[model samples]
Target: MTDPDRPVAIPAVPRPKDRPGRAPAPETTSTYRLGQGPLRLPLWLRAVILACCLVEGLLLAAPLLGLGSARAVSLMLGGFWSPLLGGGTGLYPGQGAVMFLTYGLLHAGLLHLAMNMISLAAVGRELTRMIGAGRMALIYLASQIGAGAVFALMQPQAGPMVGASGAVFGLAAALVGHAAITLRRRRRSMAPLVRAVALILGLNVALTLLMPSIAWEAHLGGALTGLALGLIFAILPRRA
Candidate 1:
């Protein structure tokens, strides 16, 4: 074949601005809202938690005022009264199912009150954000009621031990449940959250085992109840 002269080809387009900039201004999120959604939490939940804690504390101290009748008033009526759970130390219960529930509000000491209030402060606010305040209240009540049921079952002849441990435990479980659901729904792994819960549970268990002063039994009972309630809430259909 005869050789033919041909012009060498050259590139046509110019390389335009491919230099990386400051990450597209970071998606410009709108954070300044006049107000948050209605589900954000009304003052009532906060008020109830604070008011209940305060009143319960006062009731606990009322016995020091030479008012021996305070105990009777608390049990017969309401507000932080330890119900006789029919253990070897106390009298037998003579009321309906509410005794279990009633005992939930009754705390043993300032430490008990502080523990519960701290849990409520941390979990209640966040839960109200996820579910509504009404739902949070329901969860708390259900967890307490469930714990009482379990306690009565476990110790049919146990004493009348009272506290908000069950309900707070429920809240803690709900917090874990919420985190799990949120992570799953967002298509993320739950390993971190699970590890966190596991760590907390381990620490608590160890502390209880080491310190005889702590009510390890009540805490365990409450935690189990709360876990059940949290699982239920997670799977149950939300009302429209």
Candidate 2:
């Protein structure tokens, strides 16, 4: 009561950690700490993933819905066929052109879709972060078209090519290209890049030897396209 003439003392509040046997309260801020929250994917990336899943889901549910086997129907309607490029008749007109983009959305099976989507998510997330979604999307589209063209050119009699392997490969190649450029800027050895390229080629060769059905031509085409674009992007000055 008499402290008003001198100084007033206030007891300090006890922190959660200061309390005996009491643990600290969990953080409730809007920001999340490192490696603690759910991964937030880009909108476009999520949309792409959802679209692929939806297509696959619909295909799986086709028979249950009394639509009969839809795999063949979907492939015929959307799969990339080499003959179509050479003026072959399609179930619908303009399908030949549309197949260039649509083929990437179709997959042979769940395993195939899973592999492609995983790769897309991993590499795509990094690339999208480096270059905005628009450019990443552009790379993906260009890669798909390039892949289809190369597949058609190389395997003129090959069966319908489905899956996003080519686009994923393209994204990987772009990542490698960017890495190569960054290393070159630092005067580092290109051995790592060379090894990475060789490793990809070796993997493709191994997969082709084992499966014999892999569309390696498309992979090659996508890698080439992505590498070319990546190099161009790396060399160019960044925008302000």
The lDDT per prediction is 0.64, 0.84
The total number of steric clashes, by the backbone 3 Å criterion, in model 1 comes to: 3
Q: Candidate 1 has what TM-score? A: 0.68
Q: How many residue-pair clashes does candidate 2 contain?
A: 0
Q: Estimate the TM-score of every prediction.
A: 0.68, 0.80
Which candidate wins on TM-score?
A: 2
Candidate 2 off by > 4 Å: 1-40, 189-192
The worst-scoring run of ten residues by lDDT in candidate 1 lies at 80-89
Identify the runs in model 1 with alpha carbons over 4 angstroms from their true place: 1-31, 35-44, 60-64, 68-94, 210-217, 236-240
| Candidate 1 structure quality by residue, lDDT tens digits, 156-196 | 65545566767777777777877787788799988899897
Clash count of each predicted structure: 3, 0
Worst 10 residues of 2 by lDDT: 29-38
Task: For candidate 2, give the lDDT of residue 1.
Answer: 39
